[model samples]
Target: MGEENNQTVVTEFIILGFPSLKKLYPLLFLLFLLIYVFTITGNIIIFTTVLTNYKLQIPMFYFLNHLSAMEIWYTSVIVPKMLSSFVSENKSISFSSCMVQLYLFSSLGASECYLLTAMAYDRYLAICQPLHYSSKMTNLTSHQLASGSWVGGFLSPVLPVVLISKLLFCGPNQVNYFYCDAQPLLKLACSSTQFTETAITTLATGLIFSSFLLTVLSYIFIISTILGIPSITGRNKAFSTCAAHLIVVMIYYGTITAMYMQPMSRFSLDINKVLSLLYTVVTPMLNPIIYSLRNNEMKHSLTKFFKQIDKRKN
Candidate 1:
């Protein structure tokens, strides 16, 4: 079936990202530019703060450093191209470039999902099993978790791309969004997409939804433990530790769920594009804010660092 379909299908696609809003191009460009700036600045601040503040040398912050790095690359993967699309009338992506974009985007996304899970587990140990928390999330163990998250994230996209490469693209090549996504690519394939679809869906759901479930479960135990704390201060301290993780988890998972957890027939392409923007574009921008605001260590480090810079300038 795939071979038969490939004979008649098209080879490449034109990306129609934000196409109908020619009048709003300038406004959209400014908005996205601001987002890109904030996202990069915020993540960079956290990265530098973590590296400079030796007081923050713990499993939680260790995982956080990796997460910040991922956000930088993740946002970089999509935002520049999106900004270009707003300015360029053509909005075209080559066949090979599209696949590379898809692979890198998927890798970063998967790594983020697992990184969140690792953070949750770190919190769980601290809250629910305080005695063994240090032993369980030792520097060595944390290193392994962080490394695993990155490796797993990169690996998830490999199988899908391999499968996609095998298929023929002989039809309409217009991708409706700013970046190359698996579903959009799958839609443009000239051959039967049963294998590609199943593989992509399985990997996406397994990496995203399963990781989400693990994070949620970790939080459940964490919240329960927090409530059991006898003092208000103790509970507040505990919640504060996990609050940043919770906020980021909600935004990332919520957007992803909205995009992928529905029936295909019921999924609206417009809504899909909008939801994709939330996770791909907006979430990375918000991550640093969420972590910085909720974390006192980060705040203190940032303030001290800025004060040093001010003094030097004087």
Candidate 2:
């Protein structure tokens, strides 16, 4: 009975989520709870603002509307479970649930990459190619670009998730990270994971590298245009249009590149934990703040939104 004697396939994984901070569960729970609240509330505000504000019915806000929606989904896929693990005695997730988390998390993340690239391209057209900007970025075209980003992102991680899901996990079902990431899952597989790892690397590189490259190229053209404007006020206005976007792009891509580009060994547990927190939790909250703080139009719309609520309350 060789088949009967083989190790039983693992069906659940104990997420050893930030075990070093075991003594600080309360503090960590409270911290993550606050992060979750802020992230959800902030993104909801941005989404609602774009939808209701008539003045914001433009290409830039169209992309931002999608980004806000993505941030909500992206963070929800990870943080809710992470928060549960912090408070629960049993931090185990079922095999099926873990795979679902993996797919949705990867899908939303990939979608954001393409969505950000689309936003950069929109800014590039509006600033650099101003003559054809209105024609090129029509409502129909914006709708198509947004649709493509979501569809493409949802499809990008399909092969990897399917292949990885088929792997038999024989032993050591304790995941070191808070969530089911590709590297951690690969580390737990009983069979060879070289092909899976290679595939993940290539796909990740294509999404991350290509998106960053396009955004950077767009910025280069953008900066060139801004410099050619001789008027001080015009230059300031042009740069201000992109300042929020550039800040968000830097923070998001910088953390992501550092986390995924390097070897597994490079991801020290503490550093990886911190980076994961930043990417999954902090960035979502920060993006809305950056957009509203740096954008006068967003601020005004937000003001109008709150005033409307106040009027209804009275």
User: What is candidate 1's CA lDDT for residue 155?
Assistant: 88
Give residue 236's error in model 1 in angstroms: 0.8
Assess candidate 2 and give its TM-score to the true structure. Answer: 0.97
> Per-residue CA lDDT of candidate 1, range 105-210, in tens?
8899889889999999999999899899888889999999999999999988899888887788776778877788866777777678887777777777777778
Q: Return the top candidate by TM-score.
A: 2
lDDT of prediction 2:
0.91
| Tens-digit lDDT string for candidate 2 (24-139) | 99999999899899989999999999999889999999899999999999999999999998889989999999999999999998888999999999999999999999999999
RMSD of 2: 1.5
TM-score of 1: 0.94
Candidate 2: how many backbone clashes? 0
Q: Estimate every model's Cα lDDT from 0 to 1.
A: 0.85, 0.91
Q: Which runs in model 2 stand beyond 4 Å of their true positions?
A: 1-5
Clash pairs detected, candidate 2: none
